[model samples]
Target: MELRQLHYFVKVAKKEHVTQAAEELHVAQSAVSRQIHQLEEELGVKLFVQKGRNLQLTPVGQLFLKRVEVILADLERSVIEIHEFLDPEKGEIRLGFPHSLGISLIPQVVAAFRKQHPNVKFRFKQGMYPTLIRDMIKGDIDLAFISPFPDEHEFVCGEVLLTEELYAILPPGHRFSEEESIKLRELEDETFVLFSEGYSLRPIVWEACQEAGFTPKIGFEGEETDTIRGLVAAGMGVSLLPEMALHYTGPLQPAKVRVTEPQVTRTIGLIRRTNEKLPLVAKVFHAFLLRYFQERIQESQ
Candidate 1:
């Protein structure tokens, strides 16, 4: 049977009335009936039987209906994917990022790429590091921006785009705030404002504090980088934060001092499924991101 025949069968099965199905399919009722008749003849089965004014699928017809729907749906997806492959600038990208990059890095990259391919679209998913990686593996997101970039696993791979030094965020009038750069050990006595445990930044800060010979005394725990910064700026405590997270916090930003001794840093990078054959728009953004940071790093150097 032809593809149209299968399409007509599914429509007729759902609608249960030949006239209504024909009208919805924009075809004459006689044509729909003829196609349905031909499909039944080819398979040597009475696929539908009339009951009063409506049609109902026979036992085998009900089974065929389920498989035919799947086939048609898969065909439609293939058609759309090829269309995107032919003109990728008009395609869409499903992307993932952590909260840290949302305000600073993500917008800058997407805005720059869209200026060149205005028809390209983006759908973003924001979560913690492991969650984003799981999204890539499950194909929920074609790519992700992860910091302290992960090592490649059997299913996922990452590429470091840029490495930025982690800085200590101290209260504005705190003694260390006036110093140009200070050692991590110097803040051993201070209460620390930090991201909660699940956040990637939380472990980074903890590890640095551990290496510095002190376990940070907790003052307040928060999820958003802005919340952590705001608390510290209000003289609640101190914390370590990545450079990107520092850029977009507004006037309430705490005083930032570079960490000198036992200097720490985070690598902001992209992650994708190891086997993913990314859609054209996603590949375009991926390349743009890598080049964007490379150029920025070179300029700074």
Candidate 2:
């Protein structure tokens, strides 16, 4: 089968619905079906079994998928290498970052990159960690900045960019506001404001609270860090936030105090799929971010 046929087949396998796959591929459903059929015929096996409207991969299809995935990844890597050699500074780098980091870090990295490689373009998105990880695995995003590592076995390469201590964002007049740092155990009775589910920091907060001997009383759930801060400032609840998060000004100016009873820290990192080869532009950007952060860390001391 041709490489186009493999591409069509993989897309169908990913969606498990020909119509949906076709839409994602921006091609006609019939065209996708035809190519998948051609691939199956050429391979002398049934790749998918139709049950009502849903498609299921056959055993042979599953095995073929593994091989197809590797072949396609290698081919794509070669294409990236060739394209970069031909036009070093021109191409797209799709990246995702959590809102907290996106506000300041992304702009700095992008500015630095542009100063060196003006022709490069970036497609940036602010998303929760779960959504970012899903997009990265699907080959939709080249890189992501997320807190606390996920299963490292699944990704090809990743490096922790920065480690920041977690602190409680309290109302301006809260009892503990005057304290520089308070232990996690001291907040057992305090109402908590936090990011909604799917946020990378959620697990960190939960785990820290559990270690402190009580499940937090979640009073408010928000999508953005600033919103959480607003909730805390309004005395709706308190939140655990990263130190670096305080760098960005939010709508509400909550007290940024340290968590002391049992201090917790979160490491934010950049991750890419392990099996896929990163393009030259992505590699350069990754290196640049590391260097930039390293310099900042050194300068602080």
Candidate 3:
């Protein structure tokens, strides 16, 4: 079957109406119908069947569609890869990061990078710890800034950029708010709010509490840092947040106290596919990232 037939078939499968598919394809209805018919005949299988007013894929048709989607996606990626190779600086970088980093770090980092490579573009995706790793392995993202990193992965390689400590977030006027640092166990009796299970920070907080000889009584779970911070600010509960999340200023702010007893910390890292080389633009950004964080680390020292 021709590429056009596969395209038409996928469009029809998605729309479930040949007329709509034709409109989207910007082709005549007859042409779309003819190609779908030709594709089925060539494969010796009925790819689609008529429903009440819509179309549906047959069992074999569903199987074929999966393979066709992969083929088409790979073809599209190849075209983009060629274009990127021709003009790396103007190409796009598909980057992924955890939800916690999105609030401030990602925007600041992108803004700083753009100053040096103004022509380059970026497509951002927010994922949890596992999702970010899986995305890089599947070739969906060129690079990612992952946390609790320096994590040993056979399919990806990376370096630790920042090893920032976690702080106990307390509501205003709490007894511990006046302290610069508090032990993990000191908050064990307090109601705790923390990032939900998927986040890398969650486990760090949990284990630190565990080591402190207590199981934290989680009163609320949040998917974002700001949500947890707001909950803490409202006296919903106390939370342990990374150093980066505490630097920003906002109205719903909670007091940040360092966790010194157990010293909760997470590593922020830059990771990429071990077997696949990054696009030219991504490579340049990767280098810049190393230097940027390096400078920050040095300045902090």
Q: What would the TM-scores of all predictions be?
A: 0.73, 0.78, 0.84
- Residue lDDT tens for model 1, 144-258: 9988788757888868888878999998878988888999999999999989988988888888889988899998999998899889988999998888778854677699999
- The C-alpha stretches of model 1 lying farther than 4 A from their native spots are 1-80
Model 3 lDDT tens row, 35-108:
99999889998999999999999999899988888787677668767888898778888999998888788999
Task: Write candidate 2's Cα lDDT for 8-41 as tens digits.
Answer: 9888998899999999999999999999988888
Which pairs of residues clash in candidate 3, taking residues 3 or more apart in a chain or in different chains?
A: none
Query: CA RMSD for every model?
Result: 9.4, 3.7, 3.5
Winner of 2 and 3 under TM-score: 3
Rate residue 83 of model 1 by lDDT. 69
Positional deviation of residue 264's Cα in model 1 after best superposition, in angstroms: 1.4
Top-lDDT candidate index: 3
Instruction: Report the alpha-carbon TM-score of model 2 versus the true structure.
Output: 0.78
Clashing pairs in 2: 155-274, 156-273, 156-274, 182-260, 183-260, 183-261
* Candidate order (TM-score): 3, 2, 1
What overall lDDT goes with each candidate model?
A: 0.87, 0.84, 0.88
- Displacement of residue 267 (Cα, Å) in model 1 is 1.1
